[model samples]
Target chain A: MESDQYYLMRTLKVDLGERSYPIFIGQGLLDQGLMAPYIKGKQVLIVTNETIAPLYLERLISSLPNSLTVDHVVLPDGEQYKNIDQINTIFDALLEKRHNRTTTLVALGGGVIGDMTGFAAACYQRGVDFIQVPTTLLSQVDSSVGGKTGVNHPKGKNMIGAFHQPQCVVIDTDVLNTLAERELSAGMAEVIKYGLIYDEAFLCYLEDHIDGLMGLQPDLLEQAIYRSCEVKAEVVAQDEREAGIRAWLNLGHTFGHAIEAEQGYGAWLHGEAVGAGTMMAADLSCRLGWISESDVKRVESILAAANLPIYPPEQMTSVQFKEHMAVDKKVLDGSIRLVLLKEIGKATVTADFPVELFEQTLSAGDKLGKFI
Target chain B: MESDQYYLMRTLKVDLGERSYPIFIGQGLLDQGLMAPYIKGKQVLIVTNETIAPLYLERLISSLPNSLTVDHVVLPDGEQYKNIDQINTIFDALLEKRHNRTTTLVALGGGVIGDMTGFAAACYQRGVDFIQVPTTLLSQVDSSVGGKTGVNHPKGKNMIGAFHQPQCVVIDTDVLNTLAERELSAGMAEVIKYGLIYDEAFLCYLEDHIDGLMGLQPDLLEQAIYRSCEVKAEVVAQDEREAGIRAWLNLGHTFGHAIEAEQGYGAWLHGEAVGAGTMMAADLSCRLGWISESDVKRVESILAAANLPIYPPEQMTSVQFKEHMAVDKKVLDGSIRLVLLKEIGKATVTADFPVELFEQTLSAGDKLGKFI
Candidate 1:
């Protein structure tokens, strides 16, 4: 789907040759009057959930030209339903109605629906076309932009899927009206991720306007999504297939996926699980003497105020966590490569830490009560 | 996953950046002894069907490094089982065993299993390492090498999947010993496809040794497979995503997928369906004033001798056929592009043809009575 996307200027990119596209950021992209040329297709599949579908489905569909036949598939809202069974519901609906390859599937919800819908499109007749209309701040910044799509397995989340790119990404800041206070707070964790891993300047901006973001201020939310996507897009362009630098994107995900799988999907929001995982990552780095206590606390302080968990899941045993660690994508030659803090805004991937100490930190940290 | 691959001379590249690898095709590739160097991880998921596992799995597995954990998931034999729900069985098994992202999936059967298993790997955690071990002539020649992996939907065959590349492809010509005569004949259709579309020399070879191939002549099968892989691998290298030229591979699939979807899966092997579809394509070319009378008959005569069908199922009405066409991948702007033969060794993809007359020829040419 060769789309001429007008994304915020960024350093990273998702280079898949003819399929390569940029994730545009900045306000009012739907009103920019530039994306109409790339958006073509007599029929469109605007896939969302009951929660986000009714709120923004009309605006997103109206943004398209009247020549298009926009169809919608609203799913149940939550990460728990992001499984193969749930994804098949989409397949059943598409096939029953006779959806074809050229038909576009626009994912219009949080991380759960976006990932599941994108994966469905990837597998529909070896793949069709799709777009992303992320409503939640978490999706606007992270899940909704990347081509990585899949559903959770009983053993693991995102255990089944493919790398299918979206034709275009339409992020309407106005959709944030439906987002709960807890949802907004949870999404802030990923916003902090971009700064911790890529842009230090963006981190400082969050620190300054942390109050406005906590309240779901439209201007602040848009800026964060734009910057986060810019950083993500740049990284993706250079490493479309996650062979090298793209591994950096999994900074806290290895620990996060483990916690998500262990605690069960929807028990804690993805952002919250990731928030806790990020805290564990900073602690591990401190134990390994990679970063000082101040930087770790700075990371912890941000997550704590955002109402995100700052410790690992208390229900998980060290052995359970260890078993989960073995499945991480970053591990090579049976060794786990961790993306840990070298400073407040810098991180490095390393496998030199003591295994016993790492496990000890994970166990001890989880023993602590939930974030205050 | 980059290995020292020795094809004739070219670099069989997969455009998925660092995840890409060359597909080796030559005599005695199994003994050339390059698998241990390329295949990573100690644990492997060797997926094959009951028909193929007994013939050559021992030889191929023994040749590999002993340090590997090669567990096998044997499926029942047939194209009927290559569906979305069936493919999920593989994922459930992999996840139930706690198989991680680093685990390699070895597809050890023909196109049905290769497509299903490769697709399973593709969706398993958004993708895992996969190696294609094609046993049937059809798979060895085509499906085993290319990165296309998916399962069939009830509405259509291969209606769900992704463009996932295998870590490496292992084609052991020794497994054709157990292939049924009907299957061997069905496989020749694809073998002939490479020649009709790209390599005329290979087509001449098939014409020269029809009986020899039917008798399971080792040298002839190897020559056919090697040549077809060479042509297919070359095409894959040029257009990995099937954007333009790679799509030329689906010469008869536009009609074939519909027939298979209409008649149910196992009732017609994929190759048998393609064989019939190819005949219809030749006739369509004749109707369009593109191919000679004998050229159309030549395709029909040889396919008939090989015990393959030259017509589709008779029960399908024009409307039913058109309804099936709704899900074909070639449809764009709400029109299905039919790939018809311009001559014996040439084909063209166009949507400008008349549909009413085409349906009449298809309905008049039903040959399901022979198989059903």
Candidate 2:
């Protein structure tokens, strides 16, 4: 890939009437003076974690206009730190520096940073403007588009949050060059999800190029990120509040959240758990006769090709999954709603699947990918 | 007032387009099965503080339909307890009880409970339905009409919050009979505010019926609550986000929040501080040549009639007031914008006011009520 081709920028709009915003995708877009247009105020507070601060915080800050008053809060890294206490730290910094209602918050790291900063923006002075600068593959492909911002409770993942959209999303694909190989595979789980749930053609494209995508080929990565965001932006525009089709986007999240909560929040990466949980949903879908064994195997292959987990943790029991899944945001009354495949590229959220099949899938563990 | 007259219920709508909801004000509305229609789900969580639980919790629980599952979390009573920890307690109860997205949270206490419950409902599962069963006069007339909800941050009053509207507001005027003398007086401060900011006719009504309203006369109290909510609903409908005229609703809050934060929350009831803050605002407006000495005296007379303070805490200094006012939500850039009177019934939010007048008002202290 030529260096000049890497600079080609792709922008997509998540249309939600007055709340609509653009997602800018390219290499080195962070330093190209693209964020100034989206920032609504003179004061900007960049919220990043410890790891990303040393790498990209300075680059992001120096790129802004000197006339803007820019400050930042460095949070402790990891999913474990994404709680109310850490969120309060961001609020504390904003108040201490006396950032007024017109101040804008810039999220400068991965999904955890984005989630916390977005939530802080949602609540600070009863909502303020925030821009998402996602640094990781998982965030770039998934969290960057949807306005779902929140912190996890000890009992549930994203149990506390709000539907607050960003002023804009800036995806600098170059940052993924520094991402760990495991983290890259984690993001690919969501990348493959777009194909499995909404677009068979995209799934086929991912299948044909999964190797190059995982290898961090800039063109393939950009294509994957842009396509993923496009699918997400479309779905979000249709259901900004998750009152309808938006639940389809949570194809693996209910099961994934159960894994995260049962094992403790940081035990597995969010995308890793989703990778395994997608296989669980596929298994149940096959058991419900909505999809064939071959389709389940295809789901397993794509996840495996990205070096992602295909099963829950060894110590996790069926009862633990049931307990954690009971509190999922998708649950209504006492019924657990699972987002399952009707076929590759088609998904539905339903509470109508038989109980025994769900129990069997929960007990399947390592045998989940098998065609029994 | 005839016994039959007390049975008449008045309902008003807070029109925020799709987010609009009704405020139902009556003597015995809480036990009359009015909230059943507004609750969206079969699960209900009644969030009330300790002081109110024993008084009204059972009555509220029994008032709901038998088919619905009901749970209640009693929080410790007071402004000091209004923080993230208490909010987390509400979250813990909801999660422990396995409340789902379809569940409705009923705020069954005063402004503190209403704010915290509405905030919890706003964030729980990214948003859920809630009914505000405001048991205090202040909440019924003020918070019930506006969607503003949040807990207080130590650095500032109501520093952490969201603008999540309720499903409905059920005001049971009968509950005021159980309210303490000081509490009733606190509620009066807000009632007086409505007359001061938007309606001279109402201010004249308040001045004429001041003793009867403070005495909790059913006819006078009901009229005051209904008219207060009416004015608030109109203002909120015009500007739901406080971007424009809605800031006028906070006529004395800029200075009141300073008094509340400086003296420590719960020291002075929100309305008492507002009483004094209104005096301070009137003083500043007078010094700015917007109102007369007699107008300021009229403000003092009404506040004193309601048994509210007309001056800041004796220990509070000008520096403390300035420090606290600097963080008020109305502050833009580096300027402190205040909602002040242009006349007895008209109010305006401005940052362009003369600095000397503001300084003089802050330093006035006890002398604020006695104009030169």
Candidate 3:
């Protein structure tokens, strides 16, 4: 692994008709001059949290000129803090500083900080400009590239939010070294998903070079992040506000949020919980005979090799899980619609699932931790 | 006049792909069985102030079925209450009640209450479904239909907010009959704005029947309310949020807010100040040769007949007025955009007004009243 490397940057264009923006991905994006021209004014709020604050806040803040009157609100780190209360802290600090409508909020952390700050900026003074500076692997791979910003509630994750785009995104791979081993493995769960949902060949890439991805290999890491963001960007660009097909992006989120909410936030890192939920979904798909048992085994093996959680912990009963799934943002009119495996490279969302199979899958996840 | 008459029963259909909602008007829209479907099973927060609570709170509460759980928070009424401290009241009430992402907020009152409630709902849990139960005519015609929710700061009015759409709107026009003459007249200023901006025929109607509108003539009132809502609905449907062209609806707001924020809020009613501001805008438009002097005169006579203030009170100097305008939400890249007149039935936004003319208008308005 080389310390200094060149990476290709791609742009995620959120198609809001006239109100579109480019989510630029590349190394050294922060040090570029593109930000100031797009940014409308002097005031900016670089919203990060305790975990990522000490590491990247100073470097990013310094990258901005003195003319850019910048300040930051370091929120309590993690998915647990991605709610209205923490979002309010950003609003409070902004108001105290008299940062008006022209003020832009720069998100400088993972999905939690990006979602929370983007939401804060989206609703602050009706709406303001926001720039994404995603640091963590899960965010860079998927969450940070799209124009989606929101907060979690005790009841569910990302239940409340708006479809707000960032002026630009600055994703630097250097930050991934600070990520823990569990976090890295957890991120692979989603990396595996793009391949499962859209590209089988990409799935082969992860399977062949799992070690390089896990060992902070910069070139491999850049390729993974760039491709994942490209897929997400294309999907979101076609549907910015999740009206019709955009809901497909919630491939594992419906089950994932239920596990996280039921277990209490931060009990399982979002990626880990999602990793488990995705496997459970695969198993459920197998039970329904939508995908062959061989496909389910392949997904389980790949995730297991990466050390990702492939099942729910014990005590996550099927009944409570079903009820939680009903409250998912993607769930409409009391019935839950879910993304199910059709093949290794394709998935579909349906409210038309067999009751017994759905129940069986939830209970299967309930026994997962015990088996682990 | 018919005994079964309702003044505010109109709808705004915004065509922003899928983020569109209908704004319902008419007296007793809540009790008319229209809101139940939208509000069903969702946790609801009814945000009202001390002044509006005793007046309409119980009526709204009883209107909802037992299927829904309801919580209420009341703040003191006035523009001073529109800030982060006041905004946190909604957050505190939400977290305390364990309301989550699926919760719905009902903003029950005048412009101040409606704006604050909508802004609160916009930021609460990062965004939620909020219904504008606008009790004031000003809000019914202007604020409620547009999905513009936000609060005021010491520096400006509506300086922060998001364009969050309501699940539904429940307007009870009968509530206006109980309103004080002053309040009703204050609201009439906004009512008159629609006529001035896009509907000169409506302006002519107001000119001919000022007394009928004032006396609460049901047939005439319903027509006025519906037509105002019709124009607003069309504008908002075309431009859900003020990105490029939707801002034409903010004809008098820029100047109006400067007056309201600078005068310490309680000093002037929102409608009264806006009423005067519209006249100032007309005068400015004429001075900048955007419209003729006769058009300015036509604007004044209509407002004067309705007993709305036709002149900016001479308390603030040109410098003071400019200082207040500096923080306006509509200002972008240091230039302020003004919705000026082309003729009686047309208007255009221009940021290229002559500085001397802007100063002259304040001086012109100063001789009429001692603002400074």
By TM-score, the best candidate is 2
Full ranking by DockQ: 2, 1, 3
Model 2 lDDT vs. the true structure?
0.89
Clashing pairs in 2: none
lDDT of 3 by residue, B58-112 (tens): 9788878777889999988887788767777887787666676678888888878
State the fraction of real interface contacts model 1 keeps. Answer: 0.83
Quantify all predictions' global Cα lDDT against the true fold. 0.75, 0.89, 0.77
DockQ, structure candidate 2? 0.85
* TM-score of each model, in listed order: 0.89, 0.97, 0.82
lDDT-superior candidate, 2 or 3: 2
Where does candidate 1 stray beyond 4 Å?
A1-35, A313-316, A369-372, B1-34, B199-201, B314-319, B366-372
- RMSD in Å for candidate 3, one decimal? 5.0
Kindly report which residue stretches of model 2 are placed more than 4 angstroms away from their true locations once superposed: A1-6, A366-372, B1-6, B366-370
Candidate 2, after superposition: displacement of residue B85 in Å? Answer: 0.5
TM-score of 1: 0.89
Between candidates 1 and 3, the DockQ winner? 1
| Tens-place lDDT digits, model 3, residues A1-372 | 124745566565655566666666666665554576677888888888888889877877777777888878898987777777787788778867767678889888888888888888887767788988788888888777667788765655675677677887777777888888888887787888888887888889888988898897877887887778777777777776565566666777788888888888888988888888888778878888888878888988888888987888777788878777776666654577888778887878888988888887877777754321
